[model samples]
Target chain A: MSILTALARLLIFPGILFAVPAAWFFLWVERKSVAMMQGRIGPPFMQPFFDFIKLLGKSTPQRTGVAGALMRAWPLIAVSTAAGAVGLLPVLPSSGGFQGDLILLLALLEVPSICIIAAGFTSRSIFGEIGSAREAVLSVSYNVVFLLAIISVAASQHTFRLEALAQAPATSLRWIGILAVLICLPAKLHLNPFSLPNAEQEIYSGPMVEFAGPELAMWELSHGLEWVAATGLVATLIAPQMAFWGLSALAFVALSFGIVLLLSALAAATARLAIDTTVRFYWQCTIIFAVLAVSSALLMRLRS
Target chain B: MNLWKRLMCYCRRRSPWLFHLNSGSCNGCDIEIVAALAPRYDAEQLGVRLEGSPRHADILCVTGPVTRNAVCAIKTVYGQVCGPKAVVAIGSCPATTNVFIDSRTLDGPLGKHIPVDVFVPGCPPRPDAIIEGVAKAAQILAERGDEVPEVITAAEVQA
Candidate 1:
């Protein structure tokens, strides 16, 4: 057997197992962090896992809907896609230059968001419709910044490979791009101030209102993975020096978990923004930062 | 795994799930409860989930002063819940009827209609306080007695 294939299988199994606990940990961290921000004690770090277990043990309510099958499929798709995205990440790369293809990573990252929207649509509840629409809007809104940042990263590295971007020498202008990425990170993770699509108060948990029992648990699991994957991406881009196979993997997980906690703190301290306000904030304020970061990267390249 | 269970216990301590019922109020406290869920208060981060149905909920959060029209619906919902339930009266109106106390159509001081475990005193309590109250309710639910309270009010039967 080829060494790469054997290694890939080994890595993928651990990666999938890591995903389950990572997601559970994120849920606990999100709660604790948000509580700290509000001057309140948050739930224990194991809360999400117990909640999932409890839900699994509980009986699922049968709902009358044509979208039942789709709803059932969505969470599975979301979690698997999120896992795939994690696999493609350069957590433990044998070589320095672009571990997994960047284009592939980006596409995989977008899958969970799309599946969430589909789950919402299948439910056919008003809240589900609202959630689906909001999720769609969020996807479109963030993609703009995501695409721009990806383009800038590729332009600087002269390749659309993650490892190459990592291997590229750190330039002062990369900070600007990183800043843009930072802003996009919270939105991608569905943290507050930017958490419109699943605003529980406004539309009864947006897309997840109708989901109960195991289905809800799956969505929750995927959410935790999303946090891990998103933060892992950021850590990789910024801290490329830590790219050794095992150590990089460990560092990537630790750093990403820390970021999720920080964002959770911010979410607890803040309030939800009006949908209109969030859209503008992402498009105008956030996009400006991204553009500036890319421009700076370009300037640095010219100087070199 | 044991560590996770402990952490979950801690999370449940901070972020309590709230099942909000509109027991015929002016929508003021309801709005405030919702405000607690918004980003400004963002209770969800602390693990405070808002449940639509009472059966799956740990805390039964009732708003309004208990209008005559809503008493029956409230009783029915309160009965539907399993043991280890907690009732949180979200406004002064429900606690003592506040300004709406004198209305002949009102039938409240919610405790008279249902066993209220926690009273979140406010014309409309601040979102943070509401979050605190729900946390208290969750604790109560965890320690509640095994016997379910029987329906005692005449108003409960008519509705």
Candidate 2:
């Protein structure tokens, strides 16, 4: 790819410009859908945008030292990396991606969690420490299933290029792999039944307990981008190949919103789980789905 | 005002996350607060969310009369919330100390401790009333966007 094309891909379409707006829209969908499920009129369509602006307008308390600098960097790193991950999506056909882009995408997606865990520890607040610890444990437990699911899909397709995977035909193994990925989504997005790390009722936003004003806004933005990246991955997997760029982009967004609605339903229906129960559940699913996915991929490979 | 400033004010009015602080009420006002947030009243329609941390709150909702034990806590939480914030004194307790006016363990009327922007008066105000109070506070927050935040100082906390 040419430098201009790469720059355009990274800074504009499917990147920061696209992801930021989509992030807010996804957040609105989650909140609005949950509100509807509870029989209430949710906030106006622009509520998330309003929130982001309000937070930015608020004053931030000063924290003087090394910890303060690290605290500021955490959210910035998270938002930038998450936006970068979103940019890796092959939303347009002939987007020109290279070999093993899937692995790079996965790495970019993990950066926000790493930043959250670090933010929790760096805050030095008791609640932040506890939240950080829970986040660390949860990340370790869920990533096993998460990574295995993606890797299984890649193995079945016989390629680690996301564009090739997107173009590949779906298989029974791929569907099962997608199911495993779906199971990991709630934990990754910190939604209900697995919202331990930032349980507002219990930990008051965990690693974000100390963050306020602009910094808090950044974290919120990072979270919104995460919703975009994770759901976008699933959307890419499920979305049918399109002949034109406009149709492909539209289909990709529609699929992502559908996933958002499905996840919102799941979130609204369930209650938060205990930390031990969540970890145990992920480990059990990891064992069960890992076996099924791996063996099925091997069998498919052998058949070919 | 410039467009950016106007946008800030508009956004501040549109989204008001609340942090509930019970200074010593008998949980009556607290229950009413929850009722306001519940689906029946659905304060979220007006962009009011019950936040866990004061840092994220745009409005500090203080219920009940301030008890001596809760005085410092109220001060600390008030200090924790970022600027462009408002305080809503819910129920008659926080506004006038109500029936606890003579109690030795009481230290409020919340206004004596922190500046209050709105007050919803009742022994335990209804859900609708609480929502109205919050909405009023949100408006106040919008106007206060450029003003300096008034926090209780270390000496005030020590006092």
Candidate 3:
């Protein structure tokens, strides 16, 4: 097969197909796993798909005083970015991974966060504004930790290529890199304990308060994909020795998703930390872990 | 197709989303509703989602007797919920206004505002009873048609 033909095949078919289902399944796993940890039977494995279908069929209510066109289009932008980020990650065996730079991939994930904040702010509702503010605070708190963790991984592996990071040796120092990655995982997934922005009890679903119908479904799909991408990054970094082909990626995805579920359950079983407390916890707690991991990586590099 | 519809009706009978409306209640029943979602009684496992908006909801779980001031809000919320909906009069207050029956501010015994599908009798019904009431409401929802019964009047019930 010609290189150009193979590249074209990779970009269009597997890249798009891999993202939608992977994202949906990851969401299902998170819900079921959290339910199991809490000692309850969670929603069915296909619940997210069913929910998206149902939401799509419902009426889309426009918020009073918001610019109609902007509100309608924001979710599309968010979902597109989320899907784009999936391409940047090495979830599928196909090629075209270089369509995104490392910084571009990170920015793609942030697009949804920005859209969430914008949606909330545009709604002209008090709850919407408060939710947007909380989301802003959360973004500020975690953005640095996420960047530092990613930088640590890049520095240790000596390449910004996600595939290269996955192929890097699993040395003792890699364990530290693993810890830094783990701390950033919940932040990226928007799971419990780290779920300050969209706290259902406090802000009535935060930025999602006014969202309904197909717009809500798109946002939900993006969220599901974000969960997949975050967990996939962790699995790829920690256990690259696992095969990267079809079912091997599936197995690694499942294992990583299970780990995230256990963590979410732990978060749910515990009471919510105050916003200030959460901010303090992420900055202080994550920084300590990241620094230790980086130091270990440096020591290993010198010894080698 | 017939069997599938019947099975869906059966599942809907067992599970109903309870859309709680405060309508000036003292929040006693609200706490009970929350208790129903906790681990011991977890209604979520049964497919009972406590949705925020009335439009997306299936069952209207009204708490407290209707105060004169809140009567309009209650009616508005009830109207907003789509068809095939059921009204559950949660707590004794909404059912009869209970201790507040004599208050000048009360226009209640919630049946005055909307059709009451199932009456859960308690000052604040236990979480188990709330679950049972929700199940009953779901059954009513599945069976509802264009020929919904006329609103039951207080005078007719007393007679």
Each model's TM-score for chain A is 0.90, 0.96, 0.86
In the range A90-172, model 3's lDDT, one tens digit per residue, is 54443443433566777888898899899888766687788788888888888777777677677777677766666678766
Best candidate according to DockQ: 2
Q: Which segments of candidate 2 are over 4 A away from where they belong?
A: A95-100, B149-159
Q: Tens digit of lDDT per residue, candidate 1, span A1-304?
A: 3566435633563357676787788878787766666565555566786667645433355555656777778999998888878767665555443357888888888999998888888877788789889888887887888778767777776778776776677665566666667777777877788888787667877878677656777888889888877887887786656535677667776678667777887787788887788788889878987687677667757977
Best TM-score goes to which candidate?
2
Docking class of 2: medium
The lDDT values for all models are 0.72, 0.88, 0.71
Please give the DockQ score of every candidate, comma-separated: 0.13, 0.78, 0.24
Give per-residue lDDT, candidate 2, residue A243.
Answer: 87
Predicted complex 3: DockQ: 0.24
Which whole-number lDDT from 0 to 100 does residue A201 have in model 1? 64
Query: Against the true structure, what is model 1's DockQ?
Result: 0.13
| Better candidate number, 1 or 2, judged by lDDT | 2
Q: Rank the candidates by DockQ, best first.
A: 2, 3, 1
lDDT of 2 by residue, A43-157 (tens): 8899999999999988888898999899989999999999999988888765343422999999999999999999999999899999999999999999999998888899999
TM-score each candidate.
Answer: 0.73, 0.96, 0.81
List, in order, the clash count of every candidate structure.
Answer: 18, 0, 0
Q: Enumerate the chain B TM-scores of all models.
A: 0.81, 0.91, 0.88
